[model samples]
Target: MDITSPSFKENATRAIGDKSLQKALGNVERGFIYKRAKAVAAVPAFETLRDAARDIKNHTLAHLDLYLEAYADKVAATGGHVHFAETAADARDIVLDICRRVEAKTVTKGKSMITEEIALNDHLEKNGITTVETDLGEYIIQLRGEHPSHIIAPAVHLNKEQIEADFRRVHDKLPPERNLDEPVALLGEARAVLRERFLAADVGITGANFLVAETGTSIIVTNEGNGDLTQILPRVHIVVASIEKVVPTLEDASAILRVLARSATGQEMSVYTTLSTGAKRSGDPDGPDEYHVVLLDNGRSAMLGTPFEDMLRCIRCGACMNHCPVYQVVGGHAYGWVYPGPMGSVLTPTLIGVDKAGHLPNASTFCGRCESVCPMRIPLPKMMRHWRENAFARHLTPPSERSGLGVWKFLARRPALYALATGIAVRAMALLKPKGGRFRTLPFASGWTRHRDLPAPEGRTFQAMWKDRKAGK
Candidate 1:
């Protein structure tokens, strides 16, 4: 919740040293990558679905203002209240005021990154309302008094033993002898604990996966059904979501849904895809007495026409982050924000300002995996380069990096100079007599050599070879 993006290098350094976090992050590769690969491979039309999803979101964004008004009108017509917040402060105030109006003592929440972005839990708790995160992953981090490390899998940075300890520490009264040795036992216990909170909650809050303008519906997709309970069990239901979540129609939403789960968790569809249009009508079986939709802009509106606008098309499926090599090592927490990974590298700078989040974009290797795997097909590497250019132009980049780039730029612009310099450098590298023909340490490449040896240069420069071939020498 705190803006620690400025200290990302330090945070990443710390994360790298944490053995437990290293073990936990192994799941990112072992579980998510393999499952997503298999799932995508099985669907011959998955790429077509991604293209369709991207187009739907693009059309929606192009006419976003119109769609937003239509969505609001539909929500109001369905007896749901819509509140637009231009800033994070406005969103937090709007939610707190809603809690106060409901006379709420306790609020149960589904997993909503928008709420995290707005720091809603801290605001509600400070205002005398007890906010409980009913999502299993969120609940674990809440109990640990920490923010979610990953967006889709909030507690993925944690291991089973760590979770077992948290449960033991928090559920002390639930019998110390209870077996939590397996994932099922742990889940059953959390379900039981959260069920009581859900029943007692005065207000239920959730994030929307998609808001359908045609139907005036807010949709949530979940594997555990906690989102269903969080939004329906209380007298008041509050939907806190970013404005970009709006889709033109149920059909459009369905298209996006086709890719969301496959991209996110490798499932064809999540277990629960609940859609709510409004408040309870007369003779309705059971539903919330009040339904409020809080649409938070939070700098997203400013991004509409910029190079970064493509980022708005993001589904938050986390496929970008899941495939990112940088994120694979540092994990989400190192990004030092609610959002993390390649998507976070782009969006965090837009939301929080590039000056503070400059390090995130620089963290990438530009392998292009993030863009290749993204369901939205956002040009992540290009956007990251855009951020770097902005940082350099603003003189916000570190002087050392800027100077290094300046030297490289000068050399790169002149073909003859570049050829000459590269040839000399290649020969010099060979002279280093790199043990086993690899450098254990290098002057300006300590960062890389520290982790692994730098192989010595091989063969003559291509320029010399080209000249020889041309002359038939």
Candidate 2:
């Protein structure tokens, strides 16, 4: 809910040292990477499919206004009210207004990063409505009073023991003799508790994977059936989604869905894929009485016709983070926002401003792992570099970093001075190298040396060695 970005150094240090979080993240990181690799390898046309996916997204973004208008008309024709939200505030207001009109008290929710981005729950609660997150992972994080750590797995930071502790704290009505050690038991208990809330909820809110323009259907894919329940059981169903989520037709949505589950969790398909066209139809056995779709722009429309347009192709599969070295070490919370990793680095800056999120782009090792794994094939590192350049252009980079770059630039312009400085610096480091060939402490680089010792720079500078070899030859 907080708009401020925390210090990267401080948050990253804590994230790296968190033992419980590391244990949890390790299992999740390894599992997803392996599964996705297996799925991709099994499919011979995966790369070609990615190319097609990229093209579809590019074309859609190029004509976003047209598709958006078409989608509005279609949804209106289907008896669904569609509201356009130009800002986060507008989106939240639209949902809250619907709840107020219906005099709703309790709201059941599916996992939606868009809702998290708009801070919908906090706003609704402030206005005296109780919102319950239905997905198991989301419910766990909600009980812990923390934002989601990972995009796909909100409770990825919590180990079983931590979850047990949280459940014991929240599940007060549990019997004294209940077993809280195993995951199944905890899950069953949560299911029982949430079932009651589901039946009692007056409204439901969810995020759509894609909105079909032809028939005005909101498509949601989930491993658990909670999303289906959230949309159907409540009297009112509200979908909060970004404008880029709309596709031209169900056929187009199907093409994207083919790659979505495989890249996300390596599944053939999620357990539940629900498509709601409108509110309950006449003579329908079960469905919401009212359906509303809030299409949020929230700075996304500005990305149109820009290099960042490719980023909107993201289906929120979260493959980039699972394979990232920095994300593996620090986890999602270190990014200090709702979205994390490569997509987060690009999207966060656009929505929140480069000045605040500038550190995220610099956080990368530029190893190219993210770009390689991204299903959308977004040029992630190049985009991050663009953000860094933008930050530099705006003078948003720290003064210390600017001064260091200035020194390097000054020396780099002169060959003689550069070679001399390199030779002296190499010899000085060689001499100051610790007993085992590593420095335990350094004056200007204490931040680097604090966590891990730096190995001594080998014998001579590259230029000096090259000159020596030339003279001898």
RMSD per candidate (Å) reads 1.6, 2.1
Q: How accurate is candidate 2 locally (lDDT)?
A: 0.90
For model 2, state the Cα shift of residue 107 in Å.
Answer: 0.7
Model 1 regions more than 4 Å off: 466-473
Poorest 10 consecutive residues by lDDT, candidate 2? 1-10
Query: Which stretch of 10 consecutive residues in model 1 shows the poorest summed lDDT?
Result: 426-435
Candidate closest to the true structure, highest TM-score: 1
Model 1 TM-score (2 dp): 0.97
lDDT of 2 by residue, 1-473 (tens): 77535476678888888888788888865679999999999999999988888778878888888999999999999999999999999999999999999999999999999999999999999999999999999999999889987889888888889998888888887876789888999999989999999999999999999998889989999988889889999999999999999998888888888788889998867888899998999999999999999999999988887878788989999999888888888888888888898889888999888877888998899999989988888999999999999999999998988998999999999989998899888889998887999888988878778878988998589888787899995
Instruction: Report how far residue 51 has shifted in candidate 1, in Å.
Output: 1.1
Model 1, clash count?
0
Q: What is residue 259's positional error in candidate 1, in angstroms?
A: 0.6
Per-residue lDDT over 1-473 for candidate 1, one digit per residue giving the tens place of the 0 to 100 score: 67889999889889889999999999898678888888999999989999999999999999999999999999999999999999999999999999998799999999999999999999999989999999999999999999988889999999999999999999988989889999999999998998899999999999999999998999999998999998878999999999999999999999999888988888889999999999999998888999999999999999999999999998888888889888888889999898999999999999888989999899999999999989888999999999999988999997788889999999999989999899999888777765698889889878778889877887468788899999999
